[model samples]
Target: MSSKFKKRLKQLHGSREKRRRQSTQDEQSRVFTADDVEEQDLGIATSAVDAWRDHGADSRPTARGEAHFLVRHHPQSHQHGTKRLAEGAAVTLEGFRKQLNDARLHSADPSRLVFLDLETNGLSKTSFPFCIGIGVWEGSQFGVYHYFTPTEADEPASLSACAEILRDCEGLCTFNGSSFDVRMLQRRFSHYGIEHPLDDLAHLDLLHLARKLLPDRNGHKLSQLEEDVLGFGRTDDVPGAKIPGRWKQYLKTGSPHLLLDVFDHNRLDILSMVVLLPALAEGLGSSSDSARFKNRASKSDLGNRPSSSGSDQQARPPKAKPKTKLASQLSRTYALRKKAQSGGRRQPETRPTEQARQEDVPRETVKLAGSFSRAKLRRGMPIGTRLRELRGEVERLEREGRGDEERDEIVHRLHEMVALSPRNPFALERLVDYYRGTGDAALADHFAKRLDETSPF
Candidate 1:
């Protein structure tokens, strides 16, 4: 009986091993089939030389007989997502300078400003830029140009071409060029013993502007801004981290198939900057003008108000005006406050007119979480006001049983609310529940820990 039992256990073990081997074989076959499908879809080119030509890029020869890939797009015919490339020509640099409050851009010419973006292998000083995309406004048309180096030897020619394109431009506009792109390009030019064209240009880095304008935004990445501000969303764009590997693959296999997406990525970046500038300018202008108008109105009200007391009416002492910017602003604020307090008693509180009441009525309730205006939150409302509004919205959404439909956006609102007021247990509990519901164990743990730390005994 013991022998029979041992035999049965051995047979079970053997069957399990056999099934594992079969599953491994099946997985290997599936992997091979997926690879085959991918290869077939790529339509792999035969040689590097032919691959580039087939990729719709023309080659231009240099002094060392090396050539770089060149792809050009005419703004007259090219439309990047929803924005017409030609609309970039309509933007004025003077307006941008005034709106952005940058005196450096006072002399920046719109036609001479080049929109620049670079794709690099890595961030290290030793690493290099493989692709440079630039957009230039020429008359009524915007020109998009991409310079790609096929090999290390061809880098000089590509850099030279990029320099030539930028040499005539007076100003440079980039998303984060000040930190990465400009520095990288300068280092590359130094490495190649060539004169960098960026030295003389008036640089306008949009990253800083975006941060100032969209302060409440989660991130200021170009892709994020494209979605939030420009209403353009990228579909199936290659991840940036995977791009360097694709280039290495192209070098090894003589295929431009993968680099095709990289090229599109670079093009969209340049075009997005072109589309982003006007939007930035408009937003900045409106905000600045509104604040200025409010300040002026407050000062006017303070000035027109009658004296509150006999001493104020006498005005015997002549006071020196504030000399510093901060002092002047503070003085105005103090005067406004005094005027407000004095006038409150003088003017009787009257019932709201029909038009006033109608205006105060809550706006048509938006069903989706996406309708929450980030800009409105960023407009300098009191923290308590923002918290109340956010909490009220969350409560309303809960009452309506939004469930998974607006999960991500609801989470976003909670995050912003929590960021503004961390002590609030409501936001913390909701976040913990959200992460748990979404099966994000790490985030759930984090929020759970936070909830415990903040919980009252």
Candidate 2:
């Protein structure tokens, strides 16, 4: 009898493992067009919508068939945020702009940028996004719009809310979006016959970047980076892998409030991205721009917003320490040598056997040597908003024979364009044109070098 019982347990384990593998295979298959989807898929979308309607879950305005979903919309403003930077590398928006330009992206507007994270019931195609948390810049304040799917039927409405929010976003930032979050959501949208909306947005996958810059670090996971680079850590947070089980328990028995931890987990994920942006942007600067940006966010009720899980663990951000003058000078010398080689000017190779000849890492260079991270810096307004009007203004000014005045205004705009996007070769080239037209050889040459340095191609 004991042997029979053992045999049964082995069979059960084998069956579960087989199902897990099959689910993974299903997730790998994606729907791209109507030809790939069955008409029955649309019914699932409809039933999900019906579920929301039947449950009387709170509704938000959605364009996709007036579907109602449980929405947890928290609009934030007028609150001073109390979060403080732990005095790591100080990075300015301007500094990050340089890196952005290097990445060769067109724009990274704050208002049009949405930080997204999703929680789901499963990892494979069989699962749907149960919660979608979006951190967006609302005027000067940051607001998180969480779309909660309380039941299976709420899937359609929840997805629609996310689609609506994403429609206007110019870019999306995620820790590992390209691999999981994005691919899974796209699959969900395709399965439901709803158009995938994020295909066009500028996608910043922080995980890829972190891996590139922190190759020597112990691990490149967000949590690892939080501990190593940002000095922030989590407390009593629900493990992501166990989230689905918690939700399933809620659905089956509805006895526990453990789902709140999931929502809070989603919330902290959004905030972690928020807090890390400027710090990652700063690189090894003397002090972090986190404090500066936090101050800007503090004006609105966002100041007191909690970015971490609990107050149990405080971030042990690296202390801001200046490098000794000797170390700083040697670091510069080594940098110059590398830059010269990259410039194809290396003429010879020599090895120094003398211990003193070997340049020691300057303490100052240590900060700059830290691995890179990610974040955003706000600009005046979204790009498309007044561009046409500005063009019209320029045309009118030019037609009215205010060519010189128009040039000045153009220069002004160009200055802003350059400041906002230093890597913009077009802007740099235009500045070169303007300077040349003005017969300012020095200015023209200066801009030309700046343009050359900023150009990605």
Candidate 3:
């Protein structure tokens, strides 16, 4: 057989074996609670966990556990709280205030606000949320609330638990909840015949706020807000698109590990809102405060400058330079690289010229591609299209004798594409070509080996 054909066959075999092993392991290790057995004996498949395990083995553990745990744990707990946020502890008004206050002071919000983030199945009108996350500011502390679709026969009950928490809040905040999260929740409620309380709450969406406040900003993602304003970072959080797969994994295997990561990611999103609320408040509030202060200082300087023969103007503080063009370029590049990595793309080398135009790449395009590459790839568009575009642009530049200016752009784009679409043959081939063209035979061969290994007949 040809090497490519052999490799493809081997991959298929390995995939089959992996699936079989996972199935066997799931069946053997499945957690069988008395409740599940009771439901089964009654001829009712009420638990999503049991139903999932019956169908697909090798499911994620945390999601299964999350569903199972929610059902097993009573919705009402008498331990130090009034109502269950999700079958556990009630978040008191005092606690909420304290958390809100902390976020406000630390992040410097004049209004002392909170931000919310959520992940759902799709962006389509028909899409519904299987998971929800909320970020709230309480006093001086920041807290998060997350809910996953319950595994019990009563999915509505799980949603009710989430709705109850939201009802108690004086204000609701989210990044794009108005357009995405809220609407999805509303649809789910409608589907289940449940009532949604968010309609009455004081809702604040950061998406609108971000655009209004930072009109020149390239993107308005929560992660971008975190990096640009809050100066925070993250790593290895599962992409939102992988959430469904993780949920499926839990259903099959009854393992909670992958689900925990999802929960953590959701929690981080909630916390990011907490960070963002204050930062945004500060930016808006402090701007006027700063202007007033500057105007007063300027008037004083003007009066003194004339009387003192311009000595006061000279003595006054020098105007702070706007972040240098170079610095701005670097920041933009860093932000893009960071975003690419978060979305499961590779980080590229920071070439100086590429850094200059980093802002030119539409943030939405990058996000759309990163978040929906699986569907895109299924449609026969390789995940490396963006990288290809960049390489093509660079090649064109090189042909025009703008080699130095274009080289950095080429390298950066290649790096990001390779990082995102590590499995793409085109990206690997280009990397091989790039190294070969640049006289890095060793690196070229390294990529060549990877290409050969992953290539299908």
Candidate 4:
């Protein structure tokens, strides 16, 4: 019985080994069918071949055929095509003048602006363009072109094509292209011995205008700008840094799947540029109007309330009134404050009447006083004591009814106090309220601007 049991175990082991051998042989002998060949052709996995056959049998052949035909016929077309397009598409001298004229007349140019964006290998002088994307606006109709290095050896051709497109522009626009993009292009052209066309082009970089017009929010990224200004968003886009990896993947596997997303990202960048240009123009126009109105109002106020010794001076205007200097300084200060407050949840505060009249105190004196006030507060100084000191100083200034210089001196001191302890919003707000109460719009605006910057209302 023991012998029989041993024999039975040996037979089972033999059967198991046979089955394993058969499975290995079957896997090895698996036929390379048409599906496998097609999968190989499309750079798809063998397992995916079945799905392709099930769903894409008809479409695959047509796409493959077309791709092959295009590649075969235009062996060097991607490289040469770009160059041809650039040279062919360049705007003539006459065309440039015409577009500018149209822009002046209608506040818009009808030449169908081309928004250009490129993703490069890096941000250094040695960086080269791995791909280029262009979005052409032809009277509300949008066309996108994405050109990439066809082969490791075909970079020049691709770059040349890019140059051609950039050269033939009615109006060229970019986001931060002035500092980074255009400079990179110029370097690339020099390296490749190609003529840089962007040097002579009339281009507007949105970054400069953005810095000038928009509040200095942290969201200066192109993606952020697109979301905020253009009301557009993208998904499945490749991160800019991962572009090199995607290119390497395409080279290794001959799969352009990742490249498709890169193309989409580039196209979106161009479209965002298209949208941003007009929005920036509108912002600039609005800022210009506000500046003009402020200037006129400041001049009118100065004229109406001329100082006793300034009537004859006002008659001659003394080349220019000092009001312009005051107005300009106030405007700059206010603008800076407003920038700091943008996208923040703070409103400007009003100043107290007494503080407004106490504009004769020197800045150093107020700073020293505020420091003492803070130290005393920390040491359990009563709030009334602090208030009394400030009120006494303000009362003394009010009785004197000092000159403009004295008033400015007091305002300057208050500003220092506000700066040292932004938490003490009351002081800044009271100053603003005082300026408003005295009908000093510029001074009021100045405080208002500070409140905007630092207030947490």
TM-scores across all candidates? 0.51, 0.46, 0.44, 0.41
- For 54-157, candidate 3 gives per-residue lDDT tens digits of 43322223211333221111122211111122211122223223333423233233223334455555567755555556554444344555555534343555
What ranking of all candidate models by TM-score puts the best one first?
1, 2, 3, 4
lDDT of 2 by residue, 421-446 (tens): 44556556867887798676866787
* Candidate 1, residue 441: how far the Cα is off, in Å: 25
Name the runs in model 1 displaced over 4 angstroms. Answer: 1-47, 61-66, 76-82, 95-104, 287-457
**What tens-digit string does per-residue lDDT give for candidate 4 at 1-457?**
6999999999999999999999999999988799887767555443333432343221112211211101101111112211211321222323223333433223324244456677776667676776666666443245666555534444566667666666666556677777877787787777878875676666666676565555434436776555555445566677888987787776676555656677667766665555455444444345676454333323422444554445454521212435665466555555544553344424333333345348866443443322134566798887656555554555565577876544544554444344444434555776787668767687678667767877566
Taking all chains together, the TM-score of candidate 1 against the true structure is 0.51
Model 2, stretches more than 4 Å misplaced?
1-57, 65-104, 284-457
| lDDT for position 143 in model 3 | 50
Model 4's alpha-carbon lDDT is: 0.54
- Candidate 4 segments whose C-alpha is farther than 4 A from its true place: 1-112, 138-140, 286-457
Clashes of 3: 30
Q: How well is each residue in 1-457 modelled by candidate 1, as lDDT tens digits?
A: 6999999999999999999999999988874568787776445322455667766777666543445666665645566555666556566677657645677678777667889999888778798988888888776677677777766656888888777777787789999998999999999988888776687777878898777755544467888667555668789999888988888887787666767789889888888888777666655556776454333222322433444343344322323455875455345434432432353234212223445456675333322223335576688767788788878867876777775534544565676566666557898798788768756676677667767978776
Candidate 3 lDDT = 0.54
- RMSD, one per candidate, in order: 19.8, 27.2, 17.8, 19.3
Error of 4 at 353 (Å): 43
